[model samples]
Target: MAILSSNYSLESTYSLESTYSLDSIGLHTGLIKCPNCGQFHSNAMAPHGHAVWADMPKDTVDLTQDLIKMGVYSSEVVDLAKTLTENQLKVSLSQFFRDSLFERSASRNRLILEQPDLEQPDYELNSSNLVDRLCLEVVQEAGGIQAAFAAAFGDRQGELFENTIKTGKFNRRQFLARVLTVAALIMLTNCQKDNTADLTSDSPNDLAQKLEKNQLKIGFMPVTCATPIIMSQPLGFYEKYGLKVELVKMQNWAQVRDAAIAGELDAYHMIAAMPLAISLGLGSARFPIKLASIENINGNAMTAAIKHKNKVKSAANLKGFTIAIPFIYSMNNLLLRYYLAAGGVNPDRDVKLVVLTPADMVIKLANGEIDAMMCPGPFNQTAVAEKLGFIHILSSEIWPGHPCCCLATGQPWIEENPTTFRALNKAIIDGCNYASQSQHRPEIARAIAAPEYLNQPESLVKAVLTGSFEDGLGNTHNVRDRIDFDPYPWKSFSYWITTQFQRWNLMPSNVDHEAIADEVFLTGLARHLAKKLGQTPPTVILRKEQLKYDQFDPTDPESYLQGQIKKHGF
Candidate 1:
């Protein structure tokens, strides 16, 4: 019986004429050639009709013969043949006919066993067994045939295959390259699923034993600036690593540094430039320091109150106006100057910068106490929502990319308790990871802006979490980049700060930028924690580069002063 149906496409691989043709071999009996498949088939049916074929057991040949007699075939072999005939049988022939006589014969064919190439002394006694071993290994390595084909053959395999068939040996360079590529790909595939990093050698309690108890008081600002430290302490991560952590809420960065300089606070979150500035005695606290790790990155906003809205339209409009900032040496000051200069204004001469806490700045800005405030998160969001200020500058856009916060301790404290630093670093790293995850961000945001912290509206809290804040110029940024906490703390960021200090004459140019940056910080501690946690600790980390202001020569007083006056609306 020859089957013909319209459901099957004529584009099938088997010749259509053969599909309409009749009896030849045991399996081809009575079937006709299909336009796609030049083979005989049993019964033709519509797409939904399955009357000609019925499922049958693999070992029952009588069932198959009986079905053939009845013009209905359904044994495993006949069903498979019918399936292949009805649809495009796209498969490796070896896999398709695994139970067939041809497959059994091919498996039995062994040139090595028959020819005894094993007589070669160089070949091992098990060399004849290697084919099966190699096939298994290939299956494991390739994951499947498609991967094997893609790796063994180039992406454009048709062309390469033609060339290889023409030549005796396949292109060695291409083959070797593909092999190496496959090997690397397999390694990467295995690495991504690895849970080794998740399993720490020491328990949190054991890790904590490495540190001293209750002695380390860390001063952190109340804003989202100190979030990692806050999250770390409350989450019991600090305790897990043997830290008796007292999270001191400082009013501002200046006070935090003052506490650090005076040996009251062991550590604090600081602008990347703070250590260099402190080492040079540029600020209120002139203490030598050792940075532990990066704390956070890119979350500062400069804003102007509506009361001063008419007074400062752009960076150029703030030439003579007094602006509130946390510290003169902080990124707030540097970034403000950077933006003003970009707008053709010199911050040094044109603007009267008033130092104030971020909270106080918002209050002052709301009441028209200050023209503008360069403040960090949560508060920045509050200020904007309260219409206390329009965004004047966003640090992320100005610098494009850079770590914003560095966890630094007084040099004296680090020297006294090395293990404590390491333990704390691990906890902080854990906290950073926790805070960056999408699932944890909402809770982190709410926790940071809780009643005890900023005590702001939940919406404002969510805004900070989403990194949705306005630049004074009506630009908005949604910051989702993770906070990198476990990296070489003293690297290019310190050098950049040093260079800026020199460029703006914030510090003497001759000072060794490298020495200050390369100072042995607690990066070893961070690495130990990372190794324990199975993460690759950062060897070198540069804070996001500082934004470039409009190119202005600071040396010439005339150019500097005039640039400030004209650009910043002095």
Candidate 2:
């Protein structure tokens, strides 16, 4: 049995007819299943009583205890994101700042896992069929409640809605209801009129036509996961492709996201989850985002401060510890929780996670402010360089070839500037190919180690790039793929991410995960660039084998989420 569990309760109820304004945050209403009755309920169910969530109102969602525990290290950046999300501020504010804040606060009391919580709810539901129907009806119905009802059930809204008897799909149906209610409460949060002006593109015969915008601005953080993007600027890959690129090194993930959202950046290095979060309107709904290509694979590790090397040998010692991850909705959090759950440690009950940017992770670890951190790049290597931390496990050992970073851009930018997009993709593709070669890694290291780039010791940067580095236990290891660059955006990777969001309740409800993955992940761009570069792309796009978890099957996600999650699954 897993150590962590949730004392399951139902969701909060807000009046559907609440005074409407054009701008509102997400609707507070949601639905949960009754463990005893085996039926769905919209209000707080019995057995789990009403309680304050993270000291916030019950209407706001509550995170798992594992996330709550990490609240001790929460930063002000989170408040800014919430403010930006709940209400409009600057047009690009949400995308420009560092995402170092936890959306949740921690309870002062000891976290006890209860018998029931949010995990698998019998079966998966197709949200698109529902939301699309609702979104369309709302558009066609002319106005008011009739539009919402037509959108919800199309024809069966009042028939099934007013009845007391509930079916198995009732929980799924109710979620759409909440979405509709929220949609009604808030008329799209976008205050700015979208700019869809089309830019010039290539003539089929002249596929290599001049770009619409050649001067490109990109954003990055000083982490190892972004080696290709960072190295591209100095290695002349961008120049080789006839593009002048300026890499804006940002302080944190929030800033990276905000800048991208605000159009301050043409493209950026981002966590695999960040793009997904933005597309779902988790952080900001203003801009539709698209991922150009995956930037890295297996380029991270769980590093603990050197002082705790002896005291903290395994997951058991991590209880009551404050650990840090680069941001919310990231692979680091997924990997850490998997490790904890597999080791019989309840992440929510035993420890907490706080959001810290990759660079700050080294400083905080050294100061003993954070016991450990799962972060990307040179920061993990920097920790060993400074003798501040030791590597407990290379993230690859947990999930090999697991994606880390991506080359992502706002969707508006992609549509308006297709020619520029291809040029940028070609440059990025060329850089990825160059970085993949082991022989050139040392030179690549020297290029990115400039004061303007990573600004780290060349040797430290070289070690990670060349797959040879100190493991922080005094022994040197040559770890190939320690930090690698790959541009393929496998559907499996996207599907896998969707499962995690559902497992943790980061998403409102089940949507067409594969469809969304295909829409946002520009696999077509990778293929086009690969052909242009005379490189053969992978014949198979979906990953054939699972890495760390024997249970994770993207096709059958609930089997893993419900059966594998120690406390919440049951």
Candidate 3:
């Protein structure tokens, strides 16, 4: 059941009996009771498999667990464990890596350090070999059949090591050979793990640098909007890039915003407008937040309560109706306004817009507290699945390539830890690519639909992903872009958002939208991030700035704002 086995001596908890000696003459031979079995012995080697973790930290001990998850070996963990005769570069670190009391290094545990480079040795174990032999060998290496028994199999094997010592079969060569065999087995085992992907084609040392950072805390809402960010953890994207991130799920955008402002989170998913909102100080504290990539595109829908589905035939029918949006400064709100305006209903005057968390919106829609919501999926897909609501307008219909959730961080953090930011940027973009492929949608659904993660029905998530599902009106349809992912944070998309922010008067109209867009949406950062890591970053196909509907444009925003129906003045 343990993640690591077979003399997994890399454990942070281990203790071997310490021995001392006093001899006066041949008549006085040192004799002490074996602390292990309470039998008489000379050396203090009697504690027998107690707490001999020595100096290894729990994180160090648990390092191999990630290896098992990633299916790779940690050469760094090995280096920390012990340097054998083969490690010509470093001296015998036996004293440093011993079964003695020492404090585990605090700095080493925060970042998911790089998987070590284990030079595939002179010997290789093919896939056919089971590890039972390796296990027996490790049990023999503690040099005492008794100690090895206790360490490997527990206290059941009584005095076996002692009896073996008496038989004189215990040689230094055999002990050394066993240790090397066990270590080799650990390396080969890593190489054999399932999904043996070489995520970082770079050298192990290069990968180590790419993954350096403190314990990373990334905030996310348990919605499909944060799919790549959340799924990256379970999918090994984070580990591949050298980040040890704890995905903290927040209840609402407000909470996510608050945590980011307070520096409680290192990075997070944001509605495309959040970086601009945070930087302009439109919401809480004025933190200069910057976005590196757009995590998704057109992954949202406008849904109406089941009772109102027949009553609302089109956007114009939504006149005087109440609608919910997840955040005041959200792509949902802006896109909803665009869709509503095009339908001849003034979004600002004809309908009431309220902020609701995606989770809360579903309940409110079901309870009749809200008539409709321009929400993200799989919540949109969920509403349909529960028969609580039906999709009225897919966001893609409004602006086919509209940017939605983004991978954002405080501007200061990026400048301070460029390499670290670059590392994170690469991971998220990689995840975006993985999720973008249709072939991977089913697996992606399984990854994000787990209770600890999205906590939504897998079928709904899968439906949202594949763009094929029941529409809550008894009709079925397939729309491939129902919920899609792309990493480019286009400047034009920011311009569109900026115009909406102005049209809605969320902030002063006088601010420079283009300047703000350039700073907040750094597609350049996303592009250059990989190149910095010694890898050519993938060329981004930014959801083309082409506009199918003539209502919105990145340039010449004033005309679009003027043509809109009733607008906010706040």
Q: Which regions of candidate 1 fall more than 4 Å away from where they truly are?
A: 1-204, 284-286, 307-313, 469-477, 481-490, 520-528, 539-570
Model 2, 1-570: lDDT tens per residue?
111112211121121112111112331333332211222334321123334333543432232222224442122323222322212111111211111122222421111112211221101111212222323333233254444344334564433332211221333234323333333222221211111111113332233335556788899888778888888877766766556788888998888878888888889889988888888877566456788888888888899889888887777677778899988878898788777767667777788889988777788888889999998777888899889989988888888888899899887686566666766777777788888889999998898888998888899888888889998899899898887878888766877777777766778656677677766777654764675577876633454336665635555445556676655431
Residue pairs with backbone overlap in model 3: 13-53, 14-51, 14-52, 14-53, 15-51, 15-52, 36-46, 75-116, 145-161, 146-161
| Per-model CA lDDT versus the true structure | 0.53, 0.61, 0.62
2 or 3: which has the higher TM-score? 2
Q: Candidate 2: misplaced stretches above 4 Å? A: 1-209, 566-570
Ranking by lDDT: 3, 2, 1
TM-scores of the models, in the order given = 0.57, 0.63, 0.62
Which candidate has the top score in TM-score?
Answer: 2
What is the full ranking by TM-score, best candidate first? 2, 3, 1
Q: How far is candidate 2 from the true structure (C-alpha RMSD, Å)?
A: 19.5
